[model samples]
Target: MQAPINIALVGNPNSGKSSLFNALTGLNQKVSNFPGVTVDKKTGTAQIVPGLTANIIDLPGTYSLYPKSADEYVTYDVLINPDNADIPDLIIIVADASNLKRNLLFCSQIIDLKIPVIIGLTMMDIARKKGVEIDLDGLERELGVPVVSINPRKSKGVAELKKIIDLAARGNYSAAPRDFINNGALAKPVTDEIKKAVPGKSDYAALHIAVNADELHFLNIPQKAAIKQTLQTHQFNKTKVQAEEIMQRYNRIKHIMKSTVVETDPLQKQLRSEKIDDLLLHRFWGYVILLVVMFLLFQSIFWLASYPMDWIEGGFGQLSGWLTSVLPDNKITDVFVNGILAGISGFAVFIPQIMILFGLITILEDTGYMARISFLTDRLMRQVGLNGKSVMPLISGVACAVPAIMATRTIENKKERLITILVTPLMSCSARLPIYTMMIALVIPDRRIFGILGLQGLIMMGLYLLGFFMAIFIAAIMKLFVKIREKSYFIMELPVYRAPRWKNVGTTMVEKAKIFVTDAGKVIVVISVILWFLASYGPSSRMQPLHDKYEKMIAAVPADSPAADSLDKAFRSEKLSHSYAGILGHAIEPAIRPLGFDWKIGIALITSFAAREVFVGTMATLYSVGENPDDNNATLREKMAAAKWPDGRPVYTLAAGLSLMIFYSFAMQCMSTLAIVKRETKSWKMPLIQLVYMTALAYICSLIIFNIFK
Candidate 1:
């Protein structure tokens, strides 16, 4: 049996760690959550040779070995604990060649683990373009490790790096050890005690125990008494001492880099990057560009998806009509047509819009412009009591709040991360778009608000801006009470401008779409089916008597008169719907009366919570159920416009429509978001809080709007 070698891929944040992992593992990677934590664990297998394999674990990105947040703590524990099931036999520390000074801080810490290690120097091309020269051989000699320069994005130098890993794993290579501390005075006493205790054990193991007293578990210490005595004798403050030693190693690494590395034109790249940054990060122009870009993004989602949405609506309507005509009219036929098929249609219409939005975001992220956005927005975010990293999650909140909350894992401060997660759901996600668009089209005038901005567009923009500012205000208030001492620094790497990677972008969009369709789709389908059954059948024999009376009345009408023909058609349609079923809708009619919604609308609201897009489908189904069998206009909007309240008012008045839009905008409606939040938060508590807060807010706001308008 051939044994697989374990290789741990470690790096600082934005050091091309993920890119290298993707390059090595390709399609073999799987993302899972770490045990008892929401932070992601990415693992994969790579073929080191024809037969041998390497199990690669891409640890969460961190700045140093020192653990700060929950996510970073997991990385430190996994690397330091030998008892871990997935302990790596060889550690690969990837570094950004352009940012060697910062990257080496992590490299120095990893070398202290005493494992066979290799350095992967990534972004060498970027470094070269900046006119920096690296003496690879000299740096290798100083670090006591093989250094392989790679461009993972281009698949350059990957093969050579793999060869170096193979050699290290096969024990065909050895280099002189790099020592950060002299330890001359301390080593004499430590060596004598180690000689007396273990008697000719490995020198590295002795040195490890001497320095890393906190890592006694990693050494598999068999005797507690002996370990205790050794620690007492050394007077070890393990964490502090280890940190001090790591800093010493970093100093040494910095010294070597200063000597071996040469800069031919140091100011050229900095001058160019700075000049471009000035305009992009300008206080006034930056805000203008951001607003314009966001407006364009929203417009693109609506305009681009219009044709496909119409196509889907028409296709589903035609299919349902044909099914009703072909199948025998019975409960079984009704269940299949109205229950399952209608449910599927409810969720499918929004696919085009979501796909377009996700595709655009992927391009922005891959092109590295998103990082610049974060930097540009840092000052404004700070006013809201959030760091620069909060910008990504807040922007993501526009598409969906669940993932936006999950994205807060990147924030190292516990309080800041928690605050971000709590407030992100306030932003209007795409789920709220259907309600907003429908109401805005009907209620808001298309006239300009200052002869420049369209009134309807301005209101839409104001809603989004309101939510964003509210999130900030809430975060700032929370920050005043939460006592946390963690320091934050803005040190993100600005990757060189490059064309978006089409393969990665496509893969991300497909994966996100699949997750939404499958996860949220399941909940919506079930809710739609249940709602169908509720609206189709009712209790008591009251409906039967009404149906019989209506039929008799229709039969008595004069056959040649136009009034008689219209009355007969209406009578039959009403009788058929009321027979055993429509009365149930009437029963719940009072419950939603306060919000100006009838029983049918109430049913739609309940089902739409599973997904907001289901609102249109529910309306379509309910209207079709009450229409004459021969009626041709199957459009929900047309049917809705024709509907009336008991007082003879239009069912969908401007006030009612606006109230509904506001309700959906504020509500926690998507089940998939709830599910993701549950997964990311690792408990029902946080998601439950979000659910309650958002739902209550929605109801109260809608109630106020409806009553005021009434």
Candidate 2:
């Protein structure tokens, strides 16, 4: 049997490469990191025919073989390294038909490598709408390569593309014309030396090795040194050679296009998208619209998700009650119900809000407005020691900081990228939503000040904006201290606006929800089990005394009486106060008391070091354990509202509630985020410094807020 076919899907950014990849391998894809870098590598398997299976790799997008950022470098490295284990047997180049000229520049370079190349044309509909027409057969003849026009969204031409791929993998296909560029006499010496150093490599590939030998991972110290020596000996000008090669390729492409393609008179009129952008990208109005859009986003997160959130909360409460009734009253049942189930329910109830958050974000991205946001924020980002590319990661940080920090890989400037990573977590993520929501409900009045905007939502928006501004402020300060000097600029193409891809949006929503559940859920479960062990079993001396006191109190009150209910709560609270979890909380209480937090709040602060969302789960387990069994149906908000200190003052007062909100808003409570930071920066020093600074900031902010409100 023939070896499984390996196909690499390559494209410029936003060239619809990912759409084609999704079309071919719908549910068969897996994401992994590249060999020595953290950039993601996506690979999937597709059945080309009944008996032929193909391994398809979706390479990171690049505008040219010459790379800029880490992502683009990954693509270039994979293509030039012949010994790469995952190198393709066949290369499918996806190009946007609407933007053929710029897209073909990269395609031309790839073709000269003498690989079996197939052109998978995408966005033909967009091209036709712009009055651009192509003579497919004529173009195919000119380039001596097979061209298949496809609409990956509609799954059109995919079958033919698969057949072409299968044939190419088996060496049953013809190679593209390999003379796109003339290697001038000046380049002959350097190219010839590169060929001798690396046999079987095409002249174009060998030329690349000569120019970028230092950056190539496949070359060892001796190989790189030898190539450098040869280039120096020949007095080769790498830049001049590359520029001339590009001009030659484009010159040939120009004549081929004259015969094989018909384009619209672009000077005649502006596109519909450009006309729309006139208002959307306007200086003043654009900022206004942006603010309105963000306001609506936060409002929706509160209003739209409320009903489903309530249903989840009530349903879990009922489920907990039923489990309590069926299971025998014992330690095992207690742990299962209050420890494991309670923890799951805490995060499970917030899934609806999380879904809405990511769903809206996906829609924004699919419609092409997300790029414009980067464009709009570019000037402001510059003020904060970042480039326009930093805007994407900061905006994405609202959904989750791990992916946001990962997104910083696109920023080419080292100092700017590091500053962006250091401050990105300041943008309140969805994990903090649960804390913000609960605290706002506890303290903020539910009245609308502007007649249309709910006060709760407005407060939520304030928190979001507060976090964003704080990020910028912090980034500005970091700019002063980080002494690295590097030139930074932002260059991005704004794709034409299109209708949102509902299928892609839905897929993203499901995938994000799955990530949140699986990743955050794992941490929650372990912390919950440990918390239960600590909260349930205290010192034996303390445990025996509590048991004796509760037993006598129960004997004094009639069953199901008000007095019995009161005594039960007292007994449970006292037991928890002496337990190991409570002991830990008490140990830190003095340090946090100035911020209006008690021993219970201290417990939450400690557990939440695992993750910000775990604060809610910690509260759920603690409150559920202390409640009367008959009152299991009470929502957490109601339970916390009724909680009082030993001195009888309400625990969640205006001062303390505001203080808690302020703390969470500023604190760096997520271990996962810190891990991602460490990975991104390649140093524990940055994360450690970040942790100390943010925690200190949170304490000061909370302290000031509590005093002002009190």
Best by TM-score: 2
Candidate 1 on 1-710: residue-level lDDT in tens?
35888888999877888888988888788888777666778999998777679999999888877666666777876876556777788888899888888888777667755677889998777787788899999988777788888888888989998898878877865533754345333344664565456554334345445654444454446544565577778775656655665667667877988987888986846545556667766788977887876666666666687798889867877887788888898878776776677667666776776777788787877766777888887887777667888888988898788667777888877677777887888888766666676567556666765775566666667678767877787778778876557878656667655678787777777776786688667766776566666555544475567667766876787767787678766664564356433565566768667777776777677767667767766765676556654452365555677788757889888778767777777777777677877776677897788789878877788888898887
On lDDT, the candidate that comes out on top is 2
Task: For each candidate in the order shown, give its overall lDDT on alpha carbons.
Answer: 0.73, 0.87
Q: What is the lDDT of residue 671 in candidate 1?
A: 73
Listed in order, each prediction's TM-score against the native is 0.84, 0.96
Error at 700, model 2, angstroms: 1.6
Of candidate 1, the 10-residue stretch with the lowest lDDT total is: 179-188
Residue 599, model 1: lDDT of 67
lDDT of 2 at 167: 74
The Cα error of candidate 1 at residue 185, in Å, is: 8.4
Task: At residue 457, give the lDDT of candidate 1.
Answer: 61
Q: What's the CA error at residue 211 for candidate 2, in Å?
A: 0.9
